[model samples]
Target: MEQQIDSLFNWLDETTSIIEQEENTPYIEALIAASNLLFEQQVPEDLEPNYRTQLTNQVNAIQFSDFEREARQKAMQLAILKGMKGATQQHHYITPETIGVFIGYLITKFVGGQNSYRLFDPASGSGNLLLTILNQQQNMEVDSYGSEVDPTLIRLAFNNTNLQEREIEYFHQDSLKPILLEPVDVIASDLPVGYYPDDDTASSYELKAEEGHSFAHHLFIEQSIKYTKEAGYLFFVVPSFLFESEQKDQLQSYLKEHVHIVGVLELPKSMFQNEKFSRSILILQKKGPQTRDPRKVMLAQLPSFKDVEATNNVITQIDQWFKNDR
Candidate 1:
């Protein structure tokens, strides 16, 4: 579905009278009100009364108090989140369209010949990755699910999907925390990278955490693994350090025993919009305790992000590998 995000912004700009305002709280309040109206209009007419009412109440409860101290920065950051401005990629929220498309194609090929499947994104920012999959797999049927900690971004994601007439199940909760849901067939996400304050403790992520450090990103990966069904595939973007970090040896070992590392696509340094740290896409498949011979993990280096042809060429190679190997 076409994003009418601009229309939402226009409504806020006109009604909030904050077109020239410099304050953050006012803009946030206006945004909350506009978001409610946007979702209200997009909600399906045939939706169950209780479900629709619950959604409407959630929209109504979007208040200034819902945001933390970084309210202004969050508001400004929405531009990048919504693709209104080019993403710098330093934040936990930016999922570029190129990366989204690449992962979408992976999902399509991995689920080849399947008419319908469930797709989940643990850290779905504005539902870009999930929506990209819906666009790519138009001929196939899918039920999209996602969870996010940020209320603003989740609101944007909700409106984006609903506006397109795609009914998605989105949870406004931290993906790093425990969530009980039906296991899905495919799990794909640009996992949130970096450490932050969270309710999930370091002890819970003993597999991926170092002493005195608890990474939300690792917890998200753990959750993704937990939610994926046996034999389901998980496609995630993570820091390159994970591949070689001595601190992550235990976590790597655990992963090796539990799932096959199908492949790792090394991305460009500029892939995160000039972030110096490198990133890679790790594709894994869940397995049972039964022993199986390990297949060669496909490792391919992508060309510079600026070279569109080179990037597409690498994607083609990756697609061929998935097709032939499976």
Candidate 2:
């Protein structure tokens, strides 16, 4: 049974090596040790841990490993990882693993035409956004392009998103800085919500920053729309004000000249309030001749952001909106 378990769990060894090269292995290594220790500690000292077969003592220590015990261990390990990985190395951190998966699923679903494509995350904090895109792209080459103003965050994002050894372009500059690069198909971003440090607080030692906005919707909205090519999509998660604010009409007008306001999934503001909602993914497709017949806008939002399960339902409904309504 010990040999059998070793064989079965050997994949963890391979996974460890893979992540190690990317430098994401330390967390996993620590997790394995912790998992082993916690599981062992849970067992009663007096009774010998039973092997896979209670009938025989042929098994080694983990011979006592049961589905519940093993699964519980894995769950704890995963929970720890989730917590540790939750904080973004970059400023204005927002994306989480679950949210990343959700975004990846959508991007993967959309990008089926090209053999490969450049992925642009205007606000690529810790590369979670790009990683999510990579997972969804299957084996397709993802030419990642993202910018971070914070130098430390640029390093962290680059290190964190060590993408299958794929060549990537990471910039350590303000994402809002104008660039002369050619247009890309997808521009997905999660903008920052708060204000930057004011110059007054700085003794000239710290980098001076600007004032805060009631909403970052306009800023990123304008940038993404301008940068994206006609017919390419700009996916964003912004404050709830992006939806149906009085200014929304003006924002829509601006988009009309450049792109179509195709989809708006206004998530509950409170979704991230419990450290959850993250507002919502507002899907906007640039207008072009070949743009789909389903040019009408689709709105997916909750009355409020409080209930997470409802927000999840909103996610499912958003998926359904693309399929059923599209």
Candidate 3:
């Protein structure tokens, strides 16, 4: 609508005013450009609206999506054929509202009725996942913890939480040997996609001061079991290759032996088409004291252009499962 555009224009002008007040003209310009790309076009009602939003870097600098949400939406829609590339790839993934919708639905449905939940994220990339929890649960208090190795990324995560007025306890530590021992009910992470480790450079680890362990990915998963409570659940994004790779047979076997695979969300290759490797989200349940549902194996195929409202739609699905008459 013409009126809608004018309102958006006005809002952006106000935002630019703030940027100008701060003397960040260049940054403001970039934001203005990116905002246009996100809102310039209309998305299908059935599909989530995608946009290129500001993601503050660790250095407290702004990072813009090279391509606007328009590109992201197309890439997502044609994700199977066209992988992520260019601007969309360089940008830190996620939007403010989508993150909240997904996790808010999860918390309200699965973890809500309890007195409280001990929440954790081993690989809290940019604190996107953590921010969702804080935004959704404004009233109740939960014990929160996170483990991120990159100091810069960790610093950004911490600062973002504070900027949002979120209450959480985060630490700069190896995802594998996370220091926190607080009992956790739900553990989630957008881990170092197998293709991209925390640093993305094996040599960087050698170049850095700290000595390291091999197979950081597996080590982290193995340790996730250790850090989690008996009935606790873990939701993670791992490469699809993990499912059939014989190299991970033991890890998979170990999981089946000691834990439970509640479901495997076979993701679209589009999830990380821009990257070298394919990706998927795996939901695991710690084999402990919590009630188990043998009849169900929950799975979700995350669509590209994941808008918050569309993200909330998934919650409606989850609610049916959790609210079912047992």
lDDT by residue (172-253, candidate 1, tens digit) is 8867767767989999988776665653455676454555556666777777888989888899988888756655767677
Write model 2 residue lDDT over 1-326, tens digit each, in one string: 44443442443333333334443455444334323333333322443334212212222333323433223323332333443565453343546555565567667667766787766887776566666566567777777788777654565455344312335688777555575567788888887754434333222211122233323446556666667877787788776655456455656566667666666665545445553334777777778887864535677655453466876787687677667766
Score candidate 1 by TM-score against the native. 0.74
Task: Give candidate 1 misplaced runs (Cα > 4 Å).
Answer: 1-32, 35-92, 196-200, 206-210, 273-275, 289-294, 305-308
lDDT winner between candidates 2 and 3? 2
lDDT string for model 3 (244-303, tens) is 654466566677776777766555455554654666667777886665654677677655
List the pairs of residues colliding in candidate 3: 84-273, 84-274, 98-308
User: Model 3 off-target regions past 4 Å?
Assistant: 1-100, 195-214, 268-271, 274-278, 289-293, 300-320, 323-326
TM-score of each prediction: 0.74, 0.60, 0.60
Q: Which candidate number would show the highest lDDT if scored against the true structure?
A: 1
* lDDT assessment of candidate 1: 0.67
Please give the range of 10 consecutive residues that has the lowest summed lDDT in model 3.
51-60
User: Candidates' lDDT values, in order?
Assistant: 0.67, 0.56, 0.53
Residue 219 in model 3: shift from native, Å? 2.1
**Candidate number that wins on lDDT, 1 or 3:** 1
